[model samples]
Each structure stands twice: as C-alpha cells, then as structure tokens.
Target: MLTILLTAIVIINLLFIYTLVKDLIKHKDEVMSEPASTIWTPIAQVIIYFLSTFGISDFAISTALYPKAKWVSMKKLPGTLNTQCVIPVFVMALAYINSISVGVTTLLVCIVCQVIGAYVGPYFVVKLPEKVIKNFVVVGLLVASLLILAGKFNWIPANGTATELTGTKLVLTGLLMFVYGALNNIGIGSYALTMATVYAMGMNPAAAFPIMMGACTFSVSIGSMQFIKLQDYSRKITMMSVFGVIGVLIAVFLVKSLNTQMLQWVVLVVLLYSAVSLFMAGRKESEA
Candidate 1:
C-alpha cells in the first residue's frame, strides 16, 4: 500500500510540476517571490489537497492559507494577500472534524494548543522584518520538505503505533504543539510538527489526522483574526478560499480510505516548490 500510494502521488505531482513550470514562465514578469493568485491557484489547491489528502486536511489548508499571508506582509504587492484564515480554517474543520473522533482528551488538548498558537503567532510576525520573515519562512519550508521526503523514503523511520502519554512527557509534548503556532504562522505549517509530536506520543497516523486538522484550524483562526484586525490582507484571495471549500466537500467522505504514504508525497511536492520559491525570492532581494 505504501509503495503504490507513493508512486501514485509522485505521478500526480510530476504532472503538477509541469503545470507549475508553465505558470512560472507566464508569470516571469510578476514577482516570483510573492504568493501569487490567479482565479485558478486556490481552486487548483483545493483539488490537489482533496485528491492527495483525502479531505480538507490541516496541512493542506495551511499550505494553501500561507501564500496569501506571504503576499500580504512587508510592502503589500498589488496581487498579494493576507489569509482570512478564520472563514476558511473553520470551513475545512466543519467539513472533516465530525467524520472522525480522537477522544475528548486529545481533542481538548489540540484545541488549547491551537488557540494559544493562533493568538501568539502574530505577535512574532509583527516583530520581524519582511526579509528576515521571508528567510525563516523559506528555510522552514525547506526543512519541512526534507522531513516529509525523509518520512516517505524511510531515511528516518516512521514510528510504531503509540501508547497514551502522561506526566512530564505530556508537558513536553505540549511545548511542541505550542511552538507549532509560531512555525505555522511563519509558513512552516503544522502537519510535520503534529505528526512528529502526536505520533511520538503513541497515536498512529490515522488517529493523529483529525487532531492535527482541528488544532491547525484554531491556530490559523487566531492568527487570521490578528491579521484581519490589522487590515493587512487581500479580499481577492479570500474569495478564492471560499470557493475552495467546494473541493473540501467533495473529498470529505474519502478521508477514512486515505493512504498516508501517498499524501506525504503530494505534500512533499508542494513544500519543495514553496521552499525553492522562497529561496529564489530571497536571492532576488539580495541581488537588488
């Protein structure tokens, strides 16, 4: 199942790479470093996330959510955006959270961590320069991409199913989830962190899914509200996000059958593209 899923994801993403390259060529005059949107970008993301993630997964949504925010920061470019994460985050949450249950304790823990992350993340964002912010975001994307690839290739072993945690270990795990707020805001997103932390505590990947998705919804909501209050976001992209929910609804029932290995490959392609784009933008800035 792992091998077949990985291969399918690879094939799907290889085609997406072609699409990306064509778009890159057409947008050569536009700033390549910015989170760009056409009418199609968000629509395409929803489709890809549905096909690859089995539903409106958090990482996929957050990944979609970041480009708008990326385009919003520092000097606002004309087509750039700030994610109205609140509407869209909950959109996916509504679509998928009810489909699975990970117990009340885990759900509550995820909610608290995410709420804290959502509120705290923006403070960190406003404190930094756009260039520095881009640097961290880009580097973080690369790190995440590598981690996803590692998991796919088994360069680092996937952990066995976990047992419940308690005591000090739980506290330490809590720290990781809290920091994920900052990381997710910085464009690192939260899936890798959730997978590592939750799976480490003994939950299998399947059990971890709903919790991670719920946590990110809260995190992005808090963070998005902060961005919205600042009045520093794009309305155009928000429309794309709203439309993207169609894709989420289409895949809601498919969540239970998803293969983890394939999903990681799809994520890997998106992350690698994001990481490379960030680096290219930084290099362009440096040359200027």
Candidate 2:
C-alpha cells in the first residue's frame, strides 16, 4: 500500500510539473505582463498551500519563483473563497492523501475560531486603522520567523507546546486561528499563520493541517456569502477556482508522501520566505 501511494504521489507531482512547464511555454511571449504564465490561479494556490502548510501563509507565491505581480482585486476575492470549504472537506473526507490526522477536537476549535472571526471581522476592520493592523502583522511575522529559527538552531528551550499539546495549548491554538480568521478577510494568509503556530506548539504537520484548513472554511464561507449578497464578487474569477481543483488533488498526493521531518524542512524554508516578504510588505506600506 505504501509503495503504491509513493508511486502515485510521484506521478501526480510529475503531472503538475508538466502542466506548469506547458503553461510557461505557452505564455512565453506575454511573460512580462503575466509573468506568472497561464494556469496561474492553480500555481498560486499550490504555492500558497505548500508554504502555508507550515507558516508561510502567502497567497502570492505562484511557484518557487514567479509570483503574482500584485494583489487580487477585492471583488475577485469572494468569488474564489469557495475553494476554502471544498478543499478542506475533500481532504478530511479522504483524510489519507495529504494529512496525518484530522482530530475532531482540532476541527472544532478551528470552526469556532473561524466562524466567530468571520462574523466579527468587518467590525474590527472598521474599528482599527488598516495600517495599524498591517504593522502588527509584520511584527508578528518577524517574531514567528525568529521562533522557527530558534527551534532550528536550538537557541532556546522548547516551549511546552512543542513537547506535549495540552488543553490550554489547544485553546491557544484556536485563539490564533481566530486572529488569522479575522485578518484573512483583509488578505492575510490563514494557512501560513496556522501552520506556523501549530508547528511552534510542536504538533505534527498532518494534525495541524486538518485543524487549520478545516476550521478556516467557515470564515471564508461567511465572507463569500457577504460578497455575493452585496454583489461585489466577480463570478468570472470565482469560476476559476474550479481550475484549481486539479492542483488541490495533486498537492494532497505530494504532502501525504512526506513524513513529519520532510514537511518541517519545507515549512521552514517557507516560513523564512514569508517573513522576508512580510518585511517587504511592511516597507511598502510604510512608504505609502
């Protein structure tokens, strides 16, 4: 069974690579304007999933290189939000391909955090200045990056959550989710934050994922519904999410094949990149 699984993962990875190459070739002429190439939506989603599986929660990374040139239009954001529920539900229901564990307790925490955050997020936006919230996010990202490095270099003792996940640890995890859920409405990547926080707590990437992805669905759904009600979301871009379903399946295959340690390495690289990107974003915001 394990051998079959590995073989399948390799095959899926190859297919994804093939498609990515094909897109690059086809878009070679127009590479500058759409430097990300054709099939960019899935590429972005894949990178977002890969980096965020730990703490690099960026939605912009289309690949190891070649990211989207800029942010998505806010009108397009809600239309694509459907992927949040679809992918996670597919993952949990399958539960074998990409994740290690999908604990009921973890899912519960995620759901509560996301729903409350989503429902209340607009209020927070109204209350707090956008720049202030973003500045705080930059600081938090730097702190998280340092935490990952400390763990890597053995510079500090383990925070207990890294050793054993207790009830308190779990609730704190949910609170982090709540914060991510709220900010996600404004373009923060929840997956990256969730992955980073859970890793810091010493939970397995597999376990962290189900909780992180599963719960955030509620927040996205709420936002999507609002956009639909307000008629502010773009149906065309939303329809493109269907194109990413294939990539989601491929990602499940790829991640499932990785054990905890490999996932950790991939995640660390992503965390560092995300930290740098956050700093860049902060600088841009400051200049503005």
lDDT of 2 by residue, 36-80 (tens): 234665555554544444334333232222222433332233223
Query: What is the TM-score of candidate 2?
Result: 0.57
Considering summed lDDT, which 10 consecutive residues are worst modelled in model 1?
75-84
- Per-model TM-score on C-alpha atoms: 0.71, 0.57
- By lDDT, the best candidate is 1
Cα deviation of 149, candidate 2, in Å: 4.2
Evaluated at residue 107, the lDDT of candidate 1 is 58
Q: Please identify model 2 stretches exceeding 4 Å from their true place.
A: 1-39, 42-99, 123-166, 200-202, 230-235, 254-288
TM-score of 1: 0.71
User: Which regions in candidate 1 have their CA more than 4 angstroms from the true location?
Assistant: 1-38, 48-85, 155-164, 254-270
lDDT of 1 by residue, 86-192 (tens): 34444455444555545555555665776686677666666667787667766666767776666666665456464345667567766777887767666566666
